[model samples]
Target: MHHWKPPPPLSLSLRSCRFVLSFTPAPAMSASSSSEVAPTGPADAIYRDRILSSKLYFDVPPSKVPVIYSSSYDIAFFGIEKLHPFDSSKWGRICQFLIKEGFLDKKQTVEPLEASNDDLLVVHSESYLSSLKSSLNVAIIIEVPPVSLLPNCLVQNKVLYPFRKQVGGSILAAKLAKERGWAINIGGGFHHCSAEKGGGFCAYADISLCIQFAFVLLNISRVMIIDLDAHQGNGHEIDFSNDRRVYILDMYNAGIYPFDFEAKRYIDQKVELASGTKTKEYLDKLDEALEVARNNFNPELVVYNAGTDILDGDPLGRLKISPDGVTTRDEKVFRFARERNIPLLMLTSGGYMKSSARVIADSIINLSKKNLIALDSPLGRK
Candidate 1:
């Protein structure tokens, strides 16, 4: 398919922007082909440009230190409810830091998502799709307040279609990573959403959909998911359990989101992290988890859920990990996967701070840097 033109810049006071993206195989098209070219349109959006945009993009450190990550994406505003809220809330401090460094700017480019039925089917059901079309999407998923259940009226008619925008962002991030190598979505990692009913705090199975889409469209089989989110990667487990090729390292509270009352019959590899778990403990568990990924479910591409909510201050996070510790968690996950050339597709999951007035959006960007620099760079030196 031909790549489309990008959209315009954001209305917010921003300095710079980078296009978010995914990785997929370059169709028979040559490297120099215009189709093979990076994003262009309103502001030359690409995950690299946006992520690397640094302070101009957010209030974080200048991207000057040269971290890691770079991939194409169409997430501009694709993440359902995750985007606008993430930008304003406790993420302000991080945004200030980026601004101090010039990673972000008012002129940054942005765009919404576009998820197709074919992609949604990678993990969802047709009957469920019909239910979504009937606007039962959000309602079936969460009972939070009087939420609209469906997104906007236009696509809201098709329940999954609106949520597809968020799904499409993941698809774009993964495609950018697979094709160009290394992709990420500032928003996404809806792991609790299942094939039928969305669970816990999730409404869509993004990682599951992306993995299945990779299986069908990309024709790549045997995928692995390294879920380090504060919560269990339950959605992925239930979706890819029988496949065997897809393994899960779900490190979460034993009874948080999915509410594992007795047993979790769907999960492949589950790890219950005790509450108040600190950086050292989480890293130890992460190392063990990586060993599992490397030894057992060693697949071609590894879909990593780099959730930062595991940090100590995260409202939804039960663990007591710190900011540097959050970086460490990401460092361990990305290094382990990238060292072996395992294509990684990352999405930000649950992260709510006890102090909503001061969140750390930089943790997300920091992971993107590790995504880019951890390998060839001296940033994460021994």
Candidate 2:
């Protein structure tokens, strides 16, 4: 195996950078124009009111770019994270690479607020939120056995707190995307956890919460979830199963974890890849799938769960897609949304390997090179 190291920080020159101003406004829909009725029941009323009153969707100035992250998003608890297969610090590492490469300005990157309990209740059940109070439940959900032995207070501070912060980032990203045409939340896409349950290292249903907020606050009637993670995004699948307003296109390894047969039924477009699937086959399927999805549903917004677990050496994903393939995959997805003039919010979901952070950082740089995403800062150039 090749040893991985953080790339040396690049000294950049502003003259070498390219700038093109392009903005696509979201499709207009009045806030009061929903075909759905207002909430009648107590539970629905509370949820609706919480969403309406939440400050998570605060305005982001145009001067700042639409990449959302926070230092709190990285989880570390005295080496307990090392017990799991996942690289818990990958979120911070991704940002570090981008900053070191001069692709991003640390000050310009938007830091999101932590999702309060009321904000989380927008999608998660009260019982589900309460269950997280126990370290054992959180441990089981995150697949970290030693976490169970840790005190609940430590777990809450070290683990779930970071997740809540990321959840806030995911929720805010939709609002940013609608305004900016595209946004990326560096630390979200917890797609294995639904409103009622958490599993597969995903403790919160950020995708569901994001879409829900978009539907209500952004005046977005239709949304598409393009989950290209190596594992099935059963959490969001189950959340939006009966909702016609949401269309799901999930391309994942069929033989992998969370092989949820039930969630399979909810995918509008399911591209299941076998173990050892190559880059060509994967990209080919994604191309065809995107075409089909475009013909099937015209969405106002697109939620892309851009997971890097499909990287060749990722043990969990079991796919042979190269680093270049990952970049190409993201580019295609961005192009698809750009062509449609639809706003897109991308979340960095799964991929536990140490190299995952570099791969993701490289992919974002590739997107910038292709002009699919614009890093507006002058610091990152050449």
Candidate 3:
């Protein structure tokens, strides 16, 4: 286990102090059962039962487009959201652009239900969920130090609620994709959170949960995760590490956060980019990576984590990709899935800049223009 040093006494807030005082070691798991998908056993039966009984996989009306979102997906408090570099209202802004430009009607967008504790239990441990009760743990996961001072109730209502709603959207996107050729969740892609851990602004393992639900309810055996976020998707990588059913194609700036060496070992295809990688170089690597992924395994569902952080001049991502480059990147992934007749779901993940919303909305518009996706109503009007 990696050793961690405690902070100085003065820096430890009330929440952090409580968390530190109550901290305990996690129970070790056998190597065989470490993976989220272990061999058939009693635990497997429980997972299946929980998934089968979940309300998150409900059917959507044909009138509504498969663009999952909710107002609750955007978090806004007394400006506490500004503490982190992330634009907490990015999801709402993406929809606003689409609406203002008449590309999509707000009523046509599907609003997802909040993922309940039972739903979260399918991927997250009970202890992990309990740990979130301490605002300090959540603050650390989201990388906002001031959040440690807020009451847990306020944190849950103002912060975690939005994330849970997005988690719901991610899980539901898979089902929508299965039904409608392709779907997009306006918010989701918490790829840095695993079942037992949350970090890098990812408090829930939505990607992992989405695939797990698809495996059980959608009757699909194989999944491919095309994570284009500038950061490594270590959460899902670790969850599906030992499971042969999931294939991961991760392209990220290696000089970023969550430099998890152990998680890197689980990636089936890893394309590491430097800090200043440009649009052409990034796309070229993606083309090669997609070709390699195509030859490696056939997936029933493709989960695309289309993060706009790669756009040039982003402080966190540090990559030099252009806005148009992001559009082309999305087109490539959608075309890849369309060509193979595989259902695809795209999750807007990891991009934090204020311009991310405009760029994402533009990409969706481009996808519509390219005939790769249908944004209009009646279920099939491109």
Candidate 4:
């Protein structure tokens, strides 16, 4: 209902513009119906620096459309916020499978949680929150598809809790990174949310608000949001476009979702990698990303969106990167963050291909880990 004025105009190379997919909007749902569902995964994890790390709380549903705007399948799969209901078990199944593959620590498991209204206010409107409450009170017929990620704020206390939990994971991730050192939020990658509105595939006020809030609470000066989700961080790009304190490193395909509302910012970088880009070529492109992040944006605190869709064989992705390629990508990016001694915060932005998703998650986890990032739960910690 609100018209957003984009920041300044930023342009990518015309030659970089490659294939753009045509997708129709999924059927819309009444506000009340939207609140009743949850995404599938561990309830409150992905807040750590690892894939199976105690940070990711995956309640997201996977049935929604996979990530767009990339030629890389791993990039597209990493774009998936929630797993399909049918694929819900597949998430843990993938987790366990990774355990079998020696990729994940065998001790990890995910659970569920319902967040509070106060927790949600960090990113969403109070009106939307109240509406979600009233819907859950009346128990209206839930009509939306099980695969959808964005839910309406007009349902039961239980249904609406996932938003809070997901955001809580993001907020807590930022808080942990600020307090201890570094953290990764696996679920909350809502990079496209403007202050009041949600666009592109990003819904739910996740990382955007967390940092916006940290500017005050955490006193974060010169925070960097490095969005590698394969789509321009249109919402985030638009939000911090004019501000010099926050820099955006968005490496996404040109001319894609959220319709590119013509936004620009200081020290932002976007590189286009086309479909069927071989592993070595993508690695070369990553070197460009490294130069841009290090040389252009000398960040004190770096928020890394470790999207998993850059892999090959991703149903929703167009790029042809293999699992090893994705791992290498994570290594290069993580190494860059680690070597600089920059405090890092990360998230599993998007994902689809389950097996490859597990690999990317596990690989990054293997690299950027501290021995102390353990489960908050006493039993798990013990």
Best by lDDT: 3
Model 1: per-residue Cα lDDT over 1-382, one tens digit each: 0001213321221111212111221112221222222333433242224323222112212222222122221122234434222221222343344455555432231222456555455456667667655434554353332335335453353333434555666765554456534555545677876676565446677786676555434445666677777776656665654444555666776535555321244455667776788888877887887787677665656777766677675555568887777777776777777777766766766666533212334554565464543322223221
TM-score (all chains, Cα) for each model? 0.66, 0.89, 0.90, 0.64
Lowest-scoring 10 consecutive residues by lDDT in candidate 4? 65-74
Q: Residue 151 deviation, candidate 1, in Å?
A: 11
lDDT string, candidate 3, 97-145, tens digits: 9999888999998898889998898888899999999999998888788
Q: What C-alpha RMSD separates each model from the true structure? A: 13.9, 10.9, 7.5, 13.4
Q: Model 2, residue 111: what's the lDDT? A: 93
Deviation of model 2 at 356, angstroms: 0.9
Residue 166 miss distance in model 3 (angstroms): 0.5
Ranking by lDDT: 3, 2, 1, 4
Of 1 and 4, which scores higher on TM-score?
1
- Tally clashes: model 2: 0
lDDT per residue, candidate 4, 1-382, as tens digits?
0112224434543312323221101111221231212213442221111212322233322221111111111111232324231122223443444456653443333222333554445445567545444432212212123323333332232233444455556655665555445555445566666545454334455666566445434545566787766555666655554455666776654433433534433226667656566678878888887886687766667777766656676543456777777777776765677677666666766555657446755664455353223323221111
Instruction: Give me the runs in candidate 3 sitting further than 4 Å from their true place.
Output: 1-39, 380-382
Among all candidates shown, the one with the greatest TM-score: 3
Q: Rank the candidates by TM-score, best first.
A: 3, 2, 1, 4
Go through the candidates in order and give each one's C-alpha lDDT. Answer: 0.51, 0.83, 0.83, 0.48
